[model samples]
Target chain A: MMAVAADVPGAFERLVEAYEPRVKAAVARSINDRSSVEDLSQEIFLRLYRARQRYRPTARFETFLYRVIFNACVNFTQYMARRRALSLDRALDDDERGNALEPADPGMARPLENIEEQERAVMVRAAIDTLPEAQRRALLLSRYEGLGYEAIGQIMGLSLQAVKSLLWRARDNVRKALIPKLGEGPDA
Target chain B: MPDHERIGDGPVLSEAQEQQLLAYLDDRLSPDERSGVDAWLARDADLRRLLDEHRRTWELLGELPVPDEASPGAGFRENTVQRAHREERLRQRGARRRAMGVLAAAALVMALVLVLRDRPEPWARLTPEERHIVQNLELLENFDLLQQFETELDLAADVEALQAFEGELTETLR
Candidate 1:
């Protein structure tokens, strides 16, 4: 990180080039939109740059960076929430969070095919947006950034064992809703 | 999907098996362990399927595109460093100003106490004239306080300056 910061004129560009893709994928998988992923991800990296001189390589770069990205996305989710009145809280049914997969459409092929991968990506995003904050952050950090369990633990302030177990359950729960008819029960 | 990992031989993965599999997946296993896991995997179809599924999930998840790069912005580092520097300087300046203000107030109070100080009154109880002079000296010390603050402050000298008062008082005392 210090190396990246000291990069001088091209340092910020180098940071953007290196970590932008990972942060992009993390935010994309997290939110129900593609257009803002790049913009939000850049903000995270920009924040990193200013704080980089003080950066010690205590945690893996990916873990630290994703934590920032995760926060930025959550903030964005809240800010944009005012318009649609749609929110993670609103998405929850009265009973519990992971009750059943509520499909936004009744179509057979799923709307993703008709609207293009980008649009389908948005629906897939909506599914991700519904996860609890901790689970979502762990899942995204593990899946998109390729962080090891210990690294995820460090980022989320969880133990390694807890990270693995949490990720396992998070992935299982998300899969249940995202691929409702694709697999069997949660265990499957 | 977890059912895929249930091999016929073991109920749970041994440390060796766990290490072998994890290392093979990460491509960091020793050659012997590599071949061992490969051989173990070849015998167990369920294990193979689990590995395949894990890989597939990994690939599928990896396919989700990453964030976009907006330029980090103009003067981001410079602006942040400058702002912090200015704030810290202002804080130090404020602290120094407060210290000076406190010192000035304390000095003013001490000066006021000195100027208004009262001395022991001369009484009918037998008192030496020297004791009275000493009491008057104590009163004189209070007048000196004003001089400490302003070099040009002149005291209003009164009848104490008159030769007759000193002469008469000297004769009475004698």
Candidate 2:
């Protein structure tokens, strides 16, 4: 870890090589813009590189990396919101709004199965998107990334209790949103 | 009672109880708290149902598609590295410029100190005798000639002879 911090450029390449997929996925999950995922992921890496000198070894590197990702996502979301408010091009259609989630792989299932799975995926993505930003972040970090509550709190800058509250609210909100479409049962 | 809190005519779980159920589902509760929740779940069908709903919702999150691994493109790693290199160069250039600026400023200060250190004192600081010599600077400059004359002649005899010559010149003129 110290080596990664010390030799930022070299080690950062390795880090990017290793963690690019995770970073891309995290950014894609956090923001609604599918097109900006790569750009945002790049920006996150650049931020980490710039801050290498100040990278204290106090916390796990992954936690620190996620913190940077979380901050960038938050800033980007706010910027997009402001842009959306001011721009006359706000009349985004449903397809454009739900562009972040790709359809499930066709080879993985039959055609009908793939379409149904894709629809469910879109619904789930939309439900996750509908959550408040903090709750969404908490939920993604917990459920998707499998981070502990303390780590999620550190990444989101929330207290432990606040993390719990956000997760609970996030889960409850997603449940309410999904139940109407997917219904109350095991995975279909 | 809200419809969400209702489960087949069973009693509702309070907000705290629901939070506890969530913690239990996540396995975040302490052993004792887990035991407490276990006892509650064993007795309360509504609580158990709520837990199941939360768990299923969490499970449904799996449906949110993982971003395609190829989405970042092949050049992403190289592009990011090149960009970082560019930034590091800019940062180093800035540091060098700042260091040169500091060195230039220090050199200017040193030059000023040397000039001031060897500088003459103010006129007001001169003694009265020194001021007098300064006022008679032309005479002092001619002192070498005056010294030659003083060494060549007897001053008192020259004065008496000049007086005698003056008396004779005055009588002739009269």
Candidate 3:
């Protein structure tokens, strides 16, 4: 019930009212793990609150918010990729292990896992994860947020044309990845 | 009917074509362009395949549920409002602090001037010897003072010596 406090020119209420979903959407779009999304979303707002007093309208409020959220997501991704530390206290169903899905080559002569579907799911996610941040964001904003190209451009501070190009590149990569995995590759 | 009708730029889409396709998808293009792309899509199965891929991707992405934020009953709007109030307070306080600082600085300057005005003048602080020398020296130098206080006490050497001291004092002040 405690009112949030910030030290900026604009009201935190204005930012919160206008941008809560945008921030949450950004977090969800950036990360694949549902478990970490809410925490990351809270962390994004916490950073926003901390910056409120000094927050200048250097760009559109949405653009600024996206920048902050994007930075936090990048940091989280780096931490996950490196330390790979699992949050023991989180309540997500631990139905599947995070790394039980690393792809193995038959050339290595190892036995294939029983659940190839789960393995493919993991592989597909890994391919998406390897995409450049800009491409990923463009794809997510266009596809997931259901934003028009102009809106996506505003959020990402790109031109509409550039947003489309980026989205296309992302789609091309996704297609290339899916085709190989779906048994339509050259080797197959 | 377009100049790009010949197909061997490796079938690459230009920046213009890509922009057109995007506009077509978002329903921002002209009818002519839409029909053109629609015809092109029908003619080029590869391009159609790519379109289907983008379309299906979004469909799959749509099925992925958005994560629910965990907080007490105070939802996002309330939390944001609270944050805004806190921010507004901080900004107001900062502005007030700046205003107070400017007032303090102005008051300091004014206080200093008042104190200086009430105190003895810089010239008044001089020794009588210096004062007398100044009075005679000014009289001889043809200073514009029409009011004269007569004094018989001085050698010409004292005037010369005071002139040297005056020169040094003027340099120091400068």
Candidate 4:
């Protein structure tokens, strides 16, 4: 990032190469559609390049990158919301199209061997989808990305305490939704 | 771990204590806080159940399928950089074009002003006939006097009318 700031030749490309996989994964996790994933990933890089001059080192580059990711995801969600609202009139005409969020790649087999586990994963995803946007983001960043509360707080524009509470509430909500389906008990 | 301080034997898990438990699960609490939570858990099975539930919930979240690492098409970065440079170039070109247009407009206005400043007066530009009409504007303005002259010309109706016209023309010239 600092290299890009210094106008080093190929520095921006190097930066993109280093972070593209992580950013793409994050976007894929957040956004469902393949095209949106591609477009948003490109948009994120473009934003980074544009903001390179103003980039400060107050936070780690990953933190800054997460901030960009968070903003893009949030904006994309809002766009989706508006689209859903507009499509409400056509809801009756539209058939139940299954979530095309993740396309099946024959090359990649299911990570979980059991079909039941796959269903549970789906339930968890649905529960996560129901979470309020902020909580969902906080939870995903912590659980999946292994981001600490401090880093998440920086990305989320929240205090460390707030991040902790947000994650807890998010987990609690998901658990409440999941327990009826996945069941309770530590062993389960 | 935060110190387990109870003021007047309140409920075992108050809101603050709940936060502490959650934070503990998050591994955010200090040693004393951890001890405080452990003490509470040792005294109460319910709190332990709640902790377990939260922990399970956290674990289940980990069950979320890791999105496969998507490698963007080759030259993705190069293409992005090229697009950025292209956009910047176009923006600069647009700004330059606008600036040139503004300068051209200003120069045209300046040239016009200079030409007009160096040129002779409107009267000098006018033809001899147009100059004569401009000099006679006051006479044209006096409707009553011109009407009387026209009526006299009509009544005289001869060489005498011609003489009257000559007299009026000499007076108008003067």
The local lDDT score (0 to 100) that residue A32 gets in candidate 3 is 60
Superposition error at A24 for model 1 (Å)? 6.7
Off by over 4 Å in 2: A89-113, A184-188, B1-12, B69-72, B122-174
When 2 and 4 are scored with DockQ, the better candidate is 4
CA deviation > 4 Å runs, candidate 4: A91-116, A158-162, A184-188, B1-15, B69-75, B109-174
- Candidate 2: docking tier: acceptable
Segments in model 3 whose C-alpha atoms lie over 4 Å from true places: A1-22, A31-124, A183-188, B1-12, B25-28, B68-95, B125-127, B130-174
Docking class of 4: acceptable
Most accurate candidate by DockQ: 4
lDDT for each candidate structure? 0.61, 0.80, 0.64, 0.78
**lDDT of residue A20 for candidate 3:** 69
| Candidate number with the higher lDDT (2 or 4) | 2
Which model, 2 or 3, shows the larger DockQ? 2
lDDT, candidate 2, B26-133, per-residue tens = 787899999987886787666666677767787789766777632557899999989998998999999999999999999999999999888888777899999999
User: How badly does each model clash, as a count of residue pairs?
Assistant: 7, 0, 10, 7
Q: What local lDDT does model 2 show for residue B148? A: 85
| Candidates ranked by DockQ | 4, 2, 3, 1
| Worst ten in a row by lDDT for model 3 chain B | B144-153
Q: After superposition, how far is residue B79 of candidate 4 from its true place, in Å?
A: 3.4
